[model samples]
Target: MAFGRNKNRRRQDAAQRNEAVKGAVRSKGPGVMKVLALTLATGLLVWGGVELRRWALQSPRFELAAVSFSGLQRASRVELLRLAALTKGQNLWALDVGALERTMLQHPWVKKVEVSRRFPNRVSVAVTEHVPEALAVLGELYVLDEEGEPFKRVTPGDGLDLPLVTGVDREGYVADPDQARQRFQAALEVARAYTKEAVAGKPERLSEVRMEGRDVTLVAASGQEVRLGEGDSEVKLQRLARVRRELGARGLAAEIIHLDNRARPGWVAVKISSPVSERNGSAKQ
Candidate 1:
């Protein structure tokens, strides 16, 4: 009987050990499944985000509907659009703003460009064109800006009244931009001085300004050549004004006026056409 009891007790202990093992396995199963569920959820979210981005990029809603321009003075809208090469129906998100900006700036007349995209379907372009201050007479005519930088090539029907700047070669300017800039500044100064109205209320309209090395020569609208030596341009211009007034008072017109001699600031040497009385007397003799 005691031996029977021992066998029964051993069988009971074995059954308890089996139950503990099964319970432990059951406890770990939910935790493992939770981890797998979290991993699957994360993967699904990432895939959905990528797909949504792709759809948004290729969607018709992002198609460019219009392109607008502003601040354009010289550059035409059609020309700028052609240079940009941006076509309608192109995906706005796919369009490269930086690339378009660089292309537009390639136009010499376009000094600066601002490119931006309007959400839902539009591109805006703002262009700042180079303001022409004068015409530089190179082999071919070119436009000069206020900073004395040549920005564009000139064509017919342009700058009819602008003063012509001569004695600077295009090749030389390209080789030495700094020196060319200085020359342009000097020419601009002379042109401005010649065009400015003096205290006598008379403005000298210049047709051409020639830069001979450091000295400047001005050709007035009346076809008189005025030689202005380098430096002290204001003083020289004042003297020129006085000379002009004196000539008008004396009923005399000069063919040429030389103010280049710095030693004689107050003296002006003028060459005038022979008076009518003198011409008549000589004819009689």
Candidate 2:
């Protein structure tokens, strides 16, 4: 009886140990399955992303079908297209927008460029061109914008009737951009003043604005040169307008008008050839 009881106790202990092992295994099984599932999901996501990228690159849906350009004045659309190298049937997803923009900016006329991928098979380009304001004579003639920035070199038959800005060299501009800019600003100011004072129905056109240090010499369309020494250009210009009106009223023309004296702002020294009547009277005398 004792032996049978010991045997029965042993059997019960073994059965309990087996049940505990099975319960622990059952608890850890779901955790292992969850880890495996998470790893598989991550892998699938990575593979799916890679496949999507591949599809996007190789898919016909993402291929460029058309290219459109806008805000182009001087830059040719065909030239820009050639520079961009974006051909039809090229993968839109593979294009480098920044590179294309840099390529377009290589053209001197383009001030600003914007490139974008229009969804579903189109690329769009928008450009802002530099507007020529005057011709800056620096070795070769270069186009000066309103901001006094020299943007492009002129070719033959450009047919720009703008004012000429002299005394600005490439060396000066390269050595001191700020000083060059200030000089150009002053030149533009002088040009504006001249333009504002129109005689008759036509605008007063300037032939050239020569800069000498801080002083400026303006050559008019009528072959008269005005020496406007620095300080208070507005006042000087006002006095100049009066002088011009007086001369026009008397049907007189001056070879040179000097308004360089600041203290005598109202005074002007005009050089004129003696009239035919005065010359004939002097001859008779």
Candidate 3:
């Protein structure tokens, strides 16, 4: 009876151990399956992303169909397109937008450029060109923009109808850029103010604005010269208009009008070939 009881207890313990082993395996099995599923999902995502990129690179749907440009004046469309080296049927995703913009900026007339892709097949290039406002002589003729910045070298294809600003040379500009810009700016200011004035019932065009240190002398297309001093350009220009109007009514023309008198404020000196040409007075505007 004792041996049989001992054998029954041993059988019960073996059964319990087997159940615990099975229960532990059941808990660990789901954890292992979850790890494998997560790993497979991650691998599929990576593969899908790589495949999408490859497809986009060679897809006809992403081919470059059209290229558009805006704000182009001095820069021709053909020139810019040649610089970009983009062809129709080329994949848009393959083009480097940053490199394309830098290439476009190599053109002398292009001041600012922005390149963007219109999804599915188009690219646009918007450019801001440097507008030539005047011509300056700095060892070589250069085109000056509205900001008095010399941007481009003068070419035969460029328009030459703009006013000329002289006196600052290339050496001076290279040594002192700020000084040069300020000098050009002063001359440009005078030119802008003179544009609104006319002489002898005819519109006088500003031909040249010669800078001599701080002094400014304006030469018109009509061969009329005005000796304008520094500062108060607009007010002095108004006085110049009145002088021209008075001279025009009197059937006379001044070879030179001096409104740069520092000693006598508001005084003007008019010089001409006629007998009534020697005139000086407070020609207050």
Best-matching candidate per TM-score: 3
Alpha-carbon error at 204 in model 2, in Å? 2.8
lDDT of 1 by residue, 42-101 (tens): 999999999988998999999999999999877788888899898899899898999999
Report RMSD for candidate 3.
5.4
The best-first sequence of candidates by TM-score reads 3, 2, 1
Residue lDDT tens for model 2, 143-228: 88888988889977567888889888989998998889889988988887777665432435788898988888988777778999
Q: How accurate is candidate 1 locally (lDDT)?
A: 0.83
Candidate 1: regions farther than 4 A off: 1-49, 157-160, 198-202, 273-285
Tens digits of per-residue lDDT for model 3 on 54-84? 9999889999999999999889989988898
lDDT of 3: 0.87
Better of 1 and 3 by lDDT: 3
TM-score of 2: 0.80
Count backbone overlaps in model 1. Answer: 0
The candidate 1 region of ten consecutive residues with least summed lDDT is: 276-285
